[model samples]
Structures are given as C-alpha cells and as structure tokens.
Target: MTDPCGACGARGCEELFHGLLALDHSRAEPWGPLHGVSVSCFLLQHPARLPADGGAAARGLLRAYLDGGLPAVDRLIGRARAANSHRVTGRSAPGGAVPPGREAPRGGFAVTVEEVAQDGTFPAAGFPDRVRAWAAATLEVWGPVSP
Candidate 1:
C-alpha cells in the first residue's frame, strides 16, 4: 500500500515527539541467516492527551488497530513466506518444524518505546533507542533462530 507520508509510510521522530504519530508500516526488514522469517512491527500513536477535534479519532485508535491494523498485519504475516525457496523446502539444511508462536508475529505484539532523541523539548527517548537496538540486533542476527 502507498504511504501517506510519502515514503517512510509514517513521519519521523519529530512527529512522534509531538504525539502526532500514525503509521501503517509492514516489515522494517528481516534479518538472521538461520531459519529466517519475516516480522512486521506496526507502530501507531495518537495524541497523548487528545486534541479537541481528535478525541473520537484518538479514542478509537486501538479499535482501529484491532479491526484494521491487526487484520492487515495478519494478512501480511499469512502472505509472508520464506523469501529463499531453498529454505522453505528445507533444501538448505535439515531441521524440524517450528512449534508455534515462533513464526511471524501473531496479530499484534506490544512494543514499549521510552524516550530516545528529542525535539529540543521532550526526549526522543526510547523510540530511537528501541529502533536502533532492533536494527543492530537485526544486523547481528540476534538470537540466531534454529531451523
């Protein structure tokens, strides 16, 4: 789907800091060389206190996420398959089947974003930090999943 924010799908930390954040992101990108899989982490933010005109919209963010976000995510996860054909067929190596929940993210998982950077006022706080940590972990193939 096309991102309303032009490319990033959502805006940047500035928007997040101002509490004007909203996004429809899918996969930030998959990592790990092992039994690799795709994971999509969607982050949606409404005004912390809600604006006068946005109370209804803000109040319904979770519902929207549940009804729209989660279903879309599930569809994404369902449609998600191992990118490498060899891996899907186990032609790459020997491995047992995954139990469950070990696959792609189910419905919606929770992410806690504290303060990271800042908008010269509030701390960017956990948002940047978490994303950075995730990016690093991805590059290093953190946890190295077994097939």
Candidate 2:
C-alpha cells in the first residue's frame, strides 16, 4: 500500500475526505458559515490536495478567518466573486524563492481527520462543534501568517 498521507499521516485519507463531504452535505445549514474556513484549513494541511492557485487562496482565506473572523472571510469571498475570479495566484521572488505568505506548512497538522472523526459522525449532535474545533486547531498549528 502507499504511504500514509504526509499531512495528517492518515492511512485512509480518501475515506476521511468522503466523511467530511458527507458531513457537509447532511449538515449544510450548520456547516455553511464555517465551510470556507474548514475547507481552507483542510487544504492548507493537505497541500497536495490543492491546485497551484489554490494554495494561496486557501492560505488567504484561513488568514482572513483568523485575523478578522467570518466577516473578513465573507468580504474576501465577495470581492473574489465580484471580480469573477475565485483563485488567488502565488508570486515567487526573483530567484524562484516562494514569497512569504505563499508557503504552506511542510509537516503534519496539529489536528487530524482522525481526531475529528473521534467526535463522531455528521448525525452526531456534536459534529459541528468538533469540526469548528478541528479548523481552529489546524490553523493554530500553522502559526501566524507571514504577511
């Protein structure tokens, strides 16, 4: 079998993703406000799952949430939608050095999908709180944003 996921060290990463998807779908109302931050946190931890432009966007959104909470994140998403561009591209320095604020963390996150799963499934009353905690913990592990 392939090695465990580098980010979360989870052997069944795909299953975890599917479980998250199910949670999102079944708990749309509760998950709505936290969706962007949740996805951003997950993507930041699992960098390989993100596309080239996605990394920067995910980091931007996560930083926005941490710095200004949901309102700030809403503003950013609004601006992107208004511009008809949701993707945020990263810029590299002269010698191919990645610009600050553009780099994703290089190791496993402090919180993993496994930990979230321990809080129970989507139908469980505490699932939403668990997810919120997961996002917060993940962001905390990444530390402060460079920019």
Candidate 3:
C-alpha cells in the first residue's frame, strides 16, 4: 500500500513517532551498536504534549488506529518510506525486532540499560564516568523534550 507519509509496514516506527507527537516535547535515543550490530534503544520522554495542529493530527491518527483503521496508516507510511529511501543512501535503516528471549516491548518488558556505555571498552576512564557522560548527553540532546 502506498501512503502519503512514506512508511513501509513499520508500525513500530509510526508508533514511536506517534508517541513523540503525544508529548509536548520528546527525545529519541541514538541507535547504538551492540555486539557489533546497531540496535535501537527504548525511546524515553517526559510527557506527551503537542502543538495545536500537531495535536489534532496525533489525536486523529490515534483514534483511527484504536477504531480499527487498518491499512490506511500503512499506506501513508509506505509513501513516507519511499520518500525517505529515495533521499537516503543505498543503505536501508534497520528497524526494530523482537529480540529472542527478550520479553515483548508491550508486554511489560520495557527495560533501559542505563550507564551501558561505561563498559571497559568505553572511552571514559571507567563505567561510572561513561554512564554519567551518556546521561548528560541524553539530556543535552532531548532538551527538556518529553521523549
């Protein structure tokens, strides 16, 4: 299905984006490398609040999804994906996956491994310092945004 929004069967992307829209401001984490592979971290935010127009669209989309609006957002997302892919380099961005043995994100298994960047491999002197640096960085980027 083709959509004006440019998605490609990635409901998680829309869900994450939608969650961002719900907040007044939001911050998304940078995708990081794990075991030599890039992995998306759980998105974090303060509170969902939106500007007037954005709020309206978010609400409408949320309602539609809750009301069984299927295939519609999928089309919009398709369009979005097409547009994004066209603009990006040949490398397709990796989407999220249900990591084996890890509980489903929606199944009360949402977890955040803070201070993970502090491992011995971290550029910092120690794990603690690296974790502090990571937290500081996260706050700096988010800038009081809900995400």
Please name the candidate that would achieve the greatest lDDT relative to the true structure.
2
Which of the numbered candidates is closest to the native, going by highest TM-score? 2
By TM-score, is 2 or 3 better?
2
Q: Write the per-residue lDDT of candidate 3 for residues 91-144, one digit (tens) a residue.
A: 422222223353222211111122343221223234333323333332333222
Candidate 2 accuracy as TM-score: 0.67
Model 1 C-alpha lDDT per residue in residues 58-141, reported as the tens digit of each score: 223222223354354344334433434455653232112222454321211122122222332223334334443322332222
Per-prediction CA RMSD (Å): 16.3, 5.3, 18.4
For residue 14, give model 1's deviation from the true position in Å: 8.9
Error of 2 at 101 (Å): 11
Worst 10 residues of 3 by lDDT: 31-40
Q: How good is model 3 by TM-score?
A: 0.20
Scored by lDDT, model 3 comes in at 0.29
- Candidate 2 wrongly placed segments (more than 4 Å): 1-4, 85-103, 123-129, 141-143
Pairwise TM-score winner, candidates 1 and 2 = 2
Clashing pairs in 2: none
- Model 1 residue runs over 4 Å out of place are 1-48, 70-111, 115-147
CA error at residue 86 for candidate 2, angstroms: 12
- List, in order, the clash count of every candidate structure: 9, 0, 24
